[model samples]
Target: MRYESIVRNTEFSRAYRRGKSYVSPFLVTYVLRRKRGGVRLGITTSKKIGGAVQRVRARRVIREAYYAMGLNEEQSVDLVFVARTATTRVKMQKVEKAMRAHLTAAGLLSR
Candidate 1:
């Protein structure tokens, strides 16, 4: 199933206020259980990461990593992936690994 994007500022705020977070060298993930079915994903990169190009790259990397994980459709959660400055310099494999680790820790991965 395709994951929906969490586009509203309030949605991000809610997740930040009520979610559990996991931090790695490259990424910080916030997971909030939602009453709605299916998963929603949000990605954010701060200016500290770099200019527009670097920030966009960081968001793309995070998005690709989440897509690579192949999460099941039954998960009912909202996820926010926050990119750190390190993300712009890290390899894709490391980013994917970090995403998996965080998802597993949050019990979102079926296996």
Candidate 2:
């Protein structure tokens, strides 16, 4: 199932305040359980990652990695993926792997 985007500032803040986080070299992931059905995804790339081009690239890579995971639509969760500076240079596979690892650890992945 296609996941929805978490687009509001409040949504991001909610995830930050209530979520469990996992960090890797390329990404920091926050996962929060939601009462709503289906998953919502949010991605952020800070200035520390680089200039606009680099930051946008980081967001693109993170979004791609998340789409590759094929998460179940039946699950209810809010996921925020924050890009690290290292993310600008990492391959998509590495990003995807890091995401999968975190989701698995969080018990969001069914296996």
Candidate 3:
């Protein structure tokens, strides 16, 4: 499922500055609550991940893993997914599992 994306640099900054962070070898997530809006998503991968091809693949994998989470577009949250070096080396299922653990710990998986 497609999500409302967090695109602007300011929005990304706001999430980084104010959101709660969940970190694992597979991924790093920042979650911020939105009082009245649907869920928004952002994904980031650095040069440390590799070249253009690898970065794109990391993004694609994270996106697919996120879709597999079955989250609705109507949730009251904003989520940022940062790909760690390990993210590109694992299966989508492993990424999904890590994402689930982080979200569950943040109490965002209850819905």
Candidate 4:
């Protein structure tokens, strides 16, 4: 599914930093907030995740996992996904699993 438009605005990025509520595990860290159509997912992977290839893979895994879960509701929500160092050693399935696990824990997944 296509996600909503997300721009690199200082406000949105800062809001995430200021937000107290967040979900973090050994694999990823995420923050969710209500926005206006579907959820907009933003991913962050530092240089610590290895090189650009590994970072891109991590991002693709998370995005694909989100798509697979079928959370394409009209309710607007912003999700920021941060990759942890451990993500470098894990496979795509594990990355997807972590994404699903975090989303479920956040009550973003009900079905």
- Candidate lDDT (C-alpha), each: 0.92, 0.92, 0.91, 0.67
lDDT tens per residue, model 2, 23-100: 998999999998878899999988999999999999999988888888878889999999999999989999999999
- Could you estimate the TM-score for every candidate? 0.96, 0.95, 0.94, 0.76
Q: Which stretches of candidate 1 lie over 4 Å from their true place?
A: none
Model 2 scores a TM of: 0.95
Candidate 1 lDDT, tens digit per residue, 1-111? 478999999999999999999999999999999887999999988899999999999999988888888998887999999999999998888999999999999999855
Cα RMSDs of all predictions?
1.0, 1.0, 1.3, 2.5
Q: For candidate 3, give the lDDT.
A: 0.91
- Report the poorest 10 consecutive residues by lDDT, candidate 3: 69-78
Q: Report the C-alpha lDDT of model 4 over 1-111, residue by residue, as the tens digit.
A: 777645686635764675434454535544456655567767777898889998887777767766777774776577777777776666667767777777677677764
Residue pair clashes in candidate 3: none
Query: Measured by C-alpha RMSD in angstroms, how accurate is candidate 4?
Result: 2.5
- Pick the winner on TM-score between candidates 1 and 3: 1
lDDT of 3 by residue, 1-111 (tens): 778899999999999999999999989999999897688999999999999988998999999999999876767899999998888889999999999999999887873
Error of 2 at 71 (Å): 0.8
Task: Please estimate how well model 1 matches the true structure, expressed as its whole-model Cα lDDT.
Answer: 0.92
